[model samples]
Target: MNRDTLKNWQSRIDALSLRERAFLLLTAGLILGYFLYLLLIQPTWQALHQGRAELESLQTRLTALEIRSRDLASGRATPEQERLDRIAALQTQLAERESRLQARLGGILAPQQAAQLLQSILAQTRGLQLRQLHSHAGAPLFNRGSAATAAGPAVGRYNLTLEMEGGYDATRRFLQQVEQLPWTLFWDSLEYEVKDHPDAMIKLNLYTLGHS
Candidate 1:
């Protein structure tokens, strides 16, 4: 080779081995590696992490919902149980009312027998010939207690006043007979007088009270 050509070749070879060139190549390689990490590896890792977080949140929500569903299922009531509860409540109320009614009636008569008490009373007095039966013009009321003294329940007292002409013994017998009334009956007053031009006849005032 010519001396000038060989010298040019040696200069080119030396330039390739220089520190500046090496530094430039290393910098370029480092930049390419950084871009690859940002574009591919970093995005993949971030997506994976995000997916994991979302899965965990979904699992937590599902567990909470399942627990709530289980609680609701356990607390659910059957139709029969609800009906029984309602029936029990009604029975308790009916029993309380029945007890109150029995107490009010003095526990004297059964349900079926209670209805016939007034009829039985009237039937007993059918044979007695009433001369002048004067029912007091007032409310039909009576006391629930004995003697019809208006001591117990005065708002429901039943008073039956009457004037009759009979013998003293017959009047006494009639008063005694009325004591067999079903509910209750008692004489409050009994006034007697001798009738004019009567063959041993007496006018009697009879006041009685009945309770039903």
Candidate 2:
């Protein structure tokens, strides 16, 4: 039937014992308490747990930041440490420069070895006649004993002189080969004169540096 009619019938019941009424009331109270826990107390408990977790995470981050700040305040590098760092940086730069120099310098060789290479290169030139070839080791560019500590390396200069007879094109090719040698060579002086009809005489002075 209608809800009002059911309520009226329930109210008309008057045969319940006091113990039965007490049990019914206790059961109603327990049911109401369960509903209250589900609607309110459980949500509150979960919110508290979530807030505690968030607080712990924030505390951990704050502790790390505090330690970093303390280190920044008291762990500044000393002058000696800065000096050592600068020296290390300079050494690294020097190493890179040295590598580049070696590449450009080609190969390191003694004066005699460089002269032999040059002689071989000249011998390969077609339509060119070699009159004379000479090579000699010269003095160092600077006094190594006094400047050794200040300079990076000791370099000694070597001299080479050549006299040849050939056409201009052949002589140019010969010079190009010398320039393309595996070791570094520097041109000091070059003199050429038209001798007879088709041939010319050339005198060349070249300098090279070697590390000691």
Alpha-carbon TM-score of each model against the true structure: 0.30, 0.46
- Per-residue lDDT tens digits for candidate 2, residues 10-102, read 775445678877888899999999999999999999999999999999999999888777756786555676677777667566555544554
**Candidate 1 lDDT by residue in tens digits, 1-212:** 99999999778757785787788779999999999999999999999999999999999999988877776688754567667777666656555544454356652333233224433443444333445544443353421322222233333334455555545555566566555545444446666665653313333333333233
Q: What is the C-alpha lDDT of each candidate?
A: 0.54, 0.76
Q: In candidate 2, which residue pairs get closer than 3 Å at backbone N, Cα or C atoms, i.e. clash?
A: none
Model 1: worst 10 consecutive residues (lDDT sum): 142-151
Report lDDT (Cα) of residue 207, candidate 1: 33
